[model samples]
Target chain A: MQRYKGIVAYDGSGFSGYQIQPNGRTVQEEIEKALGKMHKGKPVSIVASGRTDAGVHAKRQVIHFDSALQLPSERWVKAVNGLLPGDISVMQVDAVSSDFHARFDASGKTYKYVVYTGSIRDPFKRHYAAHYPYKIDIAKVKKASEFLTGTHDFTSFCSAKTEMEKKVRTVTNISIEQNTDEIVFTFTGNGFLYNMVRIMVGTMLDVGTGKIELQTIPSILTGRDRTLAGKTAPAEGLYLWEVYY
Target chain B: MQRYKGIVAYDGSGFSGYQIQPNGRTVQEEIEKALGKMHKGKPVSIVASGRTDAGVHAKRQVIHFDSALQLPSERWVKAVNGLLPGDISVMQVDAVSSDFHARFDASGKTYKYVVYTGSIRDPFKRHYAAHYPYKIDIAKVKKASEFLTGTHDFTSFCSAKTEMEKKVRTVTNISIEQNTDEIVFTFTGNGFLYNMVRIMVGTMLDVGTGKIELQTIPSILTGRDRTLAGKTAPAEGLYLWEVYY
Candidate 1:
């Protein structure tokens, strides 16, 4: 069997999430179905680098699958893309060793959350950006983001129903960039818990809006309670930027 | 009566076009309905700088409407935006002179046509851009574009159904820009005839693909027949970029 790795980009508006779901559609199921068609009805299972929630977009997502059938790399890319919907695209495909896994072998991941802070609404960019019409204090958000970087217990930043026992995760980098009319928060980490990035973005938004102080970040982390942090931002503004190995 | 000029932007994928049509929804009808709702059942008529065909988007479209009842600029901007669908937005609203008009008072108009010439598809930008997925000769298209710059009778470049008696229009500037994976054709003119920009883009595509020679542009213009020019490009790739006073 040959192992194949591919990078995908998708508009997650119509998807339930990255994982397979029973009732609603998911990105994983759609790709698998396309792959089955290309492989002459042979079912193929794919493992993704990370699972993004419903309404979250992906600029570049990595996935790996194994198959006995040998196909040219270009043909594989075209065949899979031809069967998929217009909202999903296979950006790149490559042959990899069997030991290379998309999820388990990944070293780190990066995500970007875009917030449109302009008073005027942007019709074309509405789906990809979160509209927050209020004025933001950039200095506070910048100071707060420094506290979020490095290794820490991120239980306060994750959803309460996380299944993992270990709530500690290493956030290698966290940066807040403010443009003329938009605020972008980029997070790089070894791994992320359920809703961790969204919750962190929400808490930073609160800091920028003066609802939370910069010094409260350490207290929030120590509390180890989801309620101690700000509300989780909506999923539409989040994008899976890249996966590193 | 006060004449208010507003700059609008819309994603044309959902509308029949800028003009009001008997069948299907139109952008003009939707905005008029929103205005009536905001004006306590009184209907308002809006005149736009130019009429865009079905599925043609607009980044900045200038329009004007007259109303005897005084309304604040912010109220006009906010109320129309609140009532319009998510695809449409009123970018700016300003009170104008009573004699001001949207169509007749315009000195120039600009349109941009984007063609994606990449092997891989872009899922996020599918609706906003046209995909060609073909190798193009940029030098040939650029040479053909220079020939189409000056004033000429644009009968061949316009649709046969156009009813204008005078087919002569001056093209002030015509330039082709090649980005990393996309080719953008921008045209600035006194005005454009029916399907003029699309036909020009299509003719340029033909030149880019070596289907037609660079010298054919002058002959096509001299032919004064629509069949002599290239096919009409899809409307989704065209955007009414701006209108100059």
Candidate 2:
């Protein structure tokens, strides 16, 4: 079987998360179903870069699958996109070495969270961004983000129910871009723990609102306790922007 | 009674049209319903700048209504928006003179039509733009649009089913903006015949595709026959961009 790699984009609003479930639909289920059709009803399995939570969109999520069919790269993209729903699309596809793995071979990742800080909700972006009706001190948030950059123990930012024992991750970069009433927070890291990006954004928002001191981020990181972090941001605002390999 | 003017925005995907009908829902029906709720079912009527065909959006549709309720401009905007559906929104409101009219007093209007010219359909913009898979010669379209600008007998562009006898209209400006895979056509005119803008765009598309010759536009206009023009473009790609008084 030849292995194929692809970049997929999806609006995750209709999904019950990326993973397959007994009830409701999923991105994986749709792709696999499409693959099954391409394979003449034989079940085909595929692996994605990672599982995005429900309501979290992806600009380019990577994936890999094996197939005996020998369609060209562009044809695979067209065929898969034809079978997928309107909310999910295959952007590009290419042949990959048999040894290549979508999840394990990933070198880094980037994610973006969009926050709309407007008094009244913007009708155009209502479905894509998180609406925060209060003003945010952008400078304070930037200062707080500085503490989040670089290699550190991100256990405090992770979800409390996470089962992973190793919470140390290397954060490569963090930047906050403010455009009009929307604030976009981009995070690039070697890897992320469950809910880490959302928790970090929540804590930074707390700093912006003066609820958490800007200088307290280092202490919170050192604390390595999820309770020290602020509440998790909503999933709709988060996007899996890129997967680097 | 106080006369109030407001700027409204709507997605128009769910609306049947801008005019009220017995069996179908429209933007006019929604706003009037909202107004009735505010007036305790007193049944308030409003007039818009003009009617938008079904599936045509409005970025800033001007509307006027006379109300007995004593509310400030901002309050009227907020209250009406609260009562309106999520697809429709009131952007701004102001008190207008008693003699002011939404339809009759308007001197000009601007409409925009969006076309996505890419091999792959953009799922995100599926609701907002019309997708054209074939490539278009933009320079040719620009050349054709030049002939269409200024005063002319636009009978060839109007819908054949239209009841109006006076098909002449003054086209003040026409501009085309291309960005990435999308092209936007903006039309500012003193007035437009029924389906005039759509027919013009369709003819321009034909010119861009080499189906219609550039020099044929003037002759087509002189023909003063609806059958001589290109087909009417779909309503989903059209937007009432602005109205001038």
Candidate 3:
């Protein structure tokens, strides 16, 4: 058996999430189905670096799958892309060691959340960005982002139904950047809990809008209650930027 | 009466381009309908810098309209934005002289056509760019762009159904740039004939793909027949970049 690693990019608008679900379509199921057809009806299963929720996009998502056929790297890239829908593309494919797993071998991951804070909505950017018409204090948001960084138990920032036994995760880097009319929040971490990044972005927005104080971040983490945090931002504005090993 | 000039942007995936068409919804019609509602049932007509064909996008399209009510600039911006659909946006609004006309007073217009030349389709960019799964000779396209620059009678580039009496147009600049996997064609001209920009891009692509030699450009222009030129490119990839007066 040959293990192939692929880098993928997708528009998550039509997906129910990364993992398979009974109610709606998923990126994994679509890719697996396409792969199965390419492998002569042989079913194939893929493991991803991380699972992204519905309406979230990905610029570069890593995945691994084992196939009995020894196909060339270029053939794997082209064959899978030809069968997949227009919203999904395999950017690169390479043969990796059999033991190199996509999810298990990953050291860290990066995500970006885009917010369009202009007074007027930009129709061209509507699907790619979250529109917030309220004026925000950038300084406060920056301060709050610093407080959220470093190792901590991020229970407040995670969804309440998270199945992970340990709520502690290390956020290595956090950045808040403002361009002409957009605000971007970038986070890099060892791992993320369910809905952690979205909740963190929401809480930071609350700080920028003066709904919450900058000093409240530490206490929010200590509270370990999802309700103590701000509302989770919509999934459309979030993107899986990259996966690092 | 006060004349207001506004800069607009739109994702043309939803509308029938910038002109008002009888059979389909148009960017102009939508904005005008919203303006009429704001003016208490009085219909308003807006004149744009130029007419864009169906499915063409715009980054900055200039337009002018007359209104009897002395509405504050902010209120006008907010009211129109409040009623317009998410596909179109009014980026800026300013008071202009009554003599100012968006079409007749325009000195130059710029357009950009984006082509994704990679083998795989980019799902996120499906509606925004043209996907050409073929290898192109970038050097030949760049040389052909140079040949297209300068004042000339672009009769062959104009669509056969164009209503203009004179096909003489001044192409001030033509630039073909390739960045990684995408090719961008930018053109600046005194004015473009109906479907002229799309035809130019198509002709250039033919040269880049070696379907037609670079030397064929002058002959295509001299022939003065639309059939001599290459096929007209699709409208989805074309963007009205800006207008200068």
- The lDDT leader among the candidates is 1
Model 3 lDDT per residue over A129-212, tens place:
889878899999899989899999999999999989899999999998899889999999999899999999999999999998
**B135-210 per-residue lDDT for model 1 (tens digits):** 8999999899899998999999999999999999999998889999899999999999999999999999999998
Give model 3's docking category.
medium
Per-residue accuracy of model 3 over B1-245 as CA lDDT, tens digit each: 99999899999988777788788989999999999998998999999998887788999999999999787778787889898998899888888999999999999999999998877778877888888878898899888888888887888998898878999989999888798889899999999989899998898889989998999899988899999999998888899999999
Candidate 2 clash pair list: none
CA lDDT, candidate 3, residue B56 = 89
- Candidate achieving higher TM-score, 2 or 3: 2
In terms of lDDT, the poorest run of 10 residues in model 1 chain B is B68-77
Q: Report how closely model 2 matches the true complex, as a DockQ value.
A: 0.43
Clashing pairs in 1: none
Docking class of 2: acceptable
- Cα deviation of B75 in candidate 3 (Å)? 1.6
lDDT of 2 at B85: 80
DockQ winner between candidates 1 and 2: 1
Ranked by DockQ from best down, the candidates are 1, 3, 2
Question: Which regions of candidate 3 fall more than 4 Å away from where they truly are?
Answer: A22-25, A39-43, A96-101, A133-139, B20-25, B40-42, B133-139
**Sequence-dependent TM-score of model 2:** 0.92
